[model samples]
Target: MPADDSPTGLSQPLYLCVADELGQLIAQGQLAAGERLPSVRELSQRRGLSPTTALAALRALEQRGWVEARPQSGYYVRPKLRRLAEPATSRPPSAARPVTVGSIAARLLAASNEPGIIGFGAAIPEADWYPVATLQRLASQAARRHRLLIGEYSPFFGLPALRHQIARRYAELGIAVDDDEVVITNGCMEAINLALRTVAAPGAVIAVESPTYYGLLQLIEAQGMQALEIPTHARDGLSVEALATALTGPQGAQIRACVVTPAFCNPIGALMPEAAREALVALCRQHRIALIEDDVYGELDFAGQRPLPARYWDRSGNVLLCGSFSKSLAPGARIGWLLAGRHRDAVRMRKFTTSAGTALVYQHALSAYLETQAYPRHLVRLRRLCATNVARYIEAIERYFPAGTRVTRPSGGFVVWVELPRGTDTLALYERALFRRINFAPGPLFSASGRYRNCLRLNAGRQWTPDVDGALQALGRLVEAG
Candidate 1:
């Protein structure tokens, strides 16, 4: 295969041109596993090609499993590859719930069907823009090793090497955890669920942000627990003062656990300061509350440094730290892990009973890939690309949205929260955008209390282009119409 620098003067197809450029980078070890490639526009600008040509190159790479696409976030390098293998058991089918058309979820799902709709609703990363060739090499090596460990199930916790990697990774953030403390799971959602199950019983009261991650609310509701809403701020997240007061006040007495996204929280993209994190940990310690810290977005920082989870302040083993590769790596891999301080035994028992364990092949592959140091190297590049994309999205929002529209500037993470004018219902705007084939997450889905009716969360992980800009403009029109 001739590189783009060939002097033969034979013109390569545009897609081939883009792919050759990527291939050279991978061959030179510049694009490592888990790294994101330049956005389509960025690549197009560099290669002197159009956006469609660049996308075609990326899509071709995607088909080969060289990269994986996150829902709203841009593409990311796949961790490692295993042969096409079916899950031992299909995901237990969710029973059909009565479909209520006008309900918030139904409306949101309905809006998803419209073409050319800008999605500000879902909190997924763009998956199409990742570097795939690097992942292919990682996967090839992993698959080759999988044959040797075909019958082995990782130790009840997880692969020791991966555990050690997790510990070392956390240590860089000022969290000191031993390898034995971590238990791998399917995703942060599972990690959080297992932690909650370990500490709180059905009907227990779990305090959560008033406008918390809707998934957590569902989990609480699923466990037959009541979520006590504590007021949270868009800038600080999960107010420590409010939480301290809530605990000592009447509501605190009944709370069994407190689940929070302390760093780069979802929906609002707020990063709790170190002092507040310490204070919250102290309060949880005093109140004897099991603090489940969701730090899925912690690794995607755009600011000075990544923030440590509240777990860093815990000396009493009260904090259960949940993290996942789904956000930072490949989401479809369904891999996540938790460091359940004092609650390790309960989490382990739940893991064994819930699904036995995560896919053995994937665990082995991911472990092998991590050993290559590809993940961290990939992350540095990915973060830089994400930061650039975020700035681009911010510029678009400023240009298109109404003058008084307030937007949250996230230090890291793929979500950007836009607070629209009061009384301008996002649900109504969602309907209007849907008619125009635009999809966005309405703000109400993030709230347990049905607040933030005028807010919307935009995915800033994709390559910003003329079409993306146009989509934002269309959304602005809908917002103004409302």
Candidate 2:
């Protein structure tokens, strides 16, 4: 390892400094794969540090996947091909493509829900993350105290109390939406569906992030609208330049709406920088294209401060922002809310035609829950846990996956995008993993044109236990062998 010359008066802890030194050595090829790494005892003795600090440093590297510990054999440099690089920013064909969401997602979704598998497929938080006991208590309270609410159907705009709470949350994100402008839906899916239907019609083109949430593409396909996928980057999301080019081109007039997840987008977990977000909103406004913002994962940022959604940049109210408590709160509550802005009447009518309104029971429950400080407290814990899991998962992937397997470094949310060696078929790997009782989201599912055949998305939403780690390691082995 490089000499740990602790830079003069740094804020980083000693163990972290050690970890950084070791990481540098590995990256610089000073330490070769499969070679035995320094033991905790050696690290302590050589660095002249306490054993605890040395162990912690080694463990940090372990979590980052620099080295792996063998039960009795000590630590060794993990063997990897290191030949592949992270997937480049996507560049989908310019023209619109008719949606053809295959039947593959059905099988994967089914597998994700079924027992007997170590799941890394579904973008759901760990079960423990939800305040189940609290929700149960609230549910009973809501049933007893709000009997009248259940007896009558919810108002077209949804329960005023829930809308107010949803609006307050939006206010925190810098969108000053009135409670009356909010419409409650069964989940984020429904909110997005309503937004798509309101701004677009059959055969119209809807622009989306190239490798976006599969569910979004599924929604567009179900509505019979074509998709024009805009190129997006893994770290910074949705390319405003490409979008501008697409919107001003001859085919721009056909585009009815643009759907985007500016905060921790699914599959890739990319965040759109503030400038890009502003540019996108302005572009949409200039082109008169309606913008639908998915902020479902907005508040789960590890940094705690929420990123401003495109709605914050909207002056004409053309941006409809969608948020759901499903990922952060109880999924069973099925509580999602939308601020439709100018399209309020259209969304209100669609809500009536579809499920009428979000269930009063769920609305009341979530509303009551949000009134307490528990929601924010739960979010803090959930974010910390998810971040740690992501770090540990990255380490595991480094230790076990082949070299050249590029993975996303997400700042928030619990999904990581991994690009494997070229020609490595993730669909085939999916089948092999299912046979081994492991499930992960294959890359092709997220695209309209079936790209990313060598990529896969791993869910870090689950608690990082031995079983989860084992399954991830097995997945790496499978990719390497293939």
Candidate 3:
């Protein structure tokens, strides 16, 4: 039997104590691979540690690839931890996998129903705040005229009217694109996927911002592409110097593309400065690399002037601009488009094979909605609401979280990044919060290498309801108790 010594009296921190115990259990073969471990709550209760401490321990184990977490259910030893393969030069044949919407729905629904839980987790706008009535009117009008078109297949690129609207919108951003340059996809996610597929083969090396949107990391992993994380700043987006170093250095030449979110990036709402943006475009040009710009949150900026995307500086047509109405409008609409620039024809063909085309009816509806003067007015109001809510969230976080808790002051976007005091495990906090009828996204999810264990991103888009305050207090209590 393993030593039964109490976790107390260890010279290390309490979280370390918990982690050491788990490590010992695994070493003793008492916790074998695929074996279910105690739930975060059960472990906390058994060890007399706060739930936060228990979660930190588990997250540490998770980072080491020793465990896996299933939604709703407790933690279990991973069946196998797959190591990221080294970068390769060739493409692999496509393999078909079952698309499971159920898993995604379960996670979203579970997160939605948590009592006393402030939903700072999803990137979605609050349900009541979006312009639902306007969309309804637009949809009705579109159906009145395009009833026949709804039953037919949309062109592989997209509905012509929608593409024209997209191109016109890009003109305002200083990106000179015509209707043919735009390719509609299910959402910005698919736009990005198609862009990556068009430019690079599987197992190819691609550069991505550190602490990028978790969805992007998942996409890279799914495509069997290896990502080299370029160090980025909280205030200025991706560091051009770091990127230049990566590009000119040994790893730079092999990188097929660089993916960035230039404006109001997810997790970190950094907007690249104009000079930095120029430099980035120049760097990509110098290195002959493709720059895939994810600008999903560009329209949500509430601070200074909304900076144009890096695509504006793409004189060489190396930049692919991917954007969507998912964040600005309702996510269910799933209307997203891409300006593939030089890769237009390649992307068009990929779009033909992959989902055929985005829903034509939604595209027409959104196009009509965009033509109205109300769209920009609605966006202005939405930005103000997000800014106000984010300010309140910062105040609440300051009041409740312990000293030394570092929170990001994002100029725009609905998410906030909180850096907890070192050694705090957010995943542990997540598990504990679940029991308290709260849910949050843990930090490690945003990293490709499973780093950032002490960091957590909160969705500040929702209103500061009483339940939200209570949840913040609860989270604070968990941190302090640890």
The CA lDDT of each predicted structure is 0.71, 0.83, 0.75
List, residue by residue over 325-398, the lDDT tens digit for candidate 3: 99887677898988888888888889888998777777887888778776776677667667756655665676
Per-model TM against the reference: 0.76, 0.85, 0.76
Which runs of model 3 end up more than 4 angstroms from their true locations?
Answer: 1-117
Supply candidate 1's per-residue lDDT for 338.
90
* RMSD in angstroms between candidate 1 and the native structure over all alpha carbons: 12.8
Candidate 2 residue-wise lDDT at 252 = 95
Best prediction by TM-score: 2
lDDT of 1: 0.71
Cα-based lDDT at residue 88, candidate 1:
16
For model 2, give the 10-residue run with minimal summed lDDT. Answer: 1-10
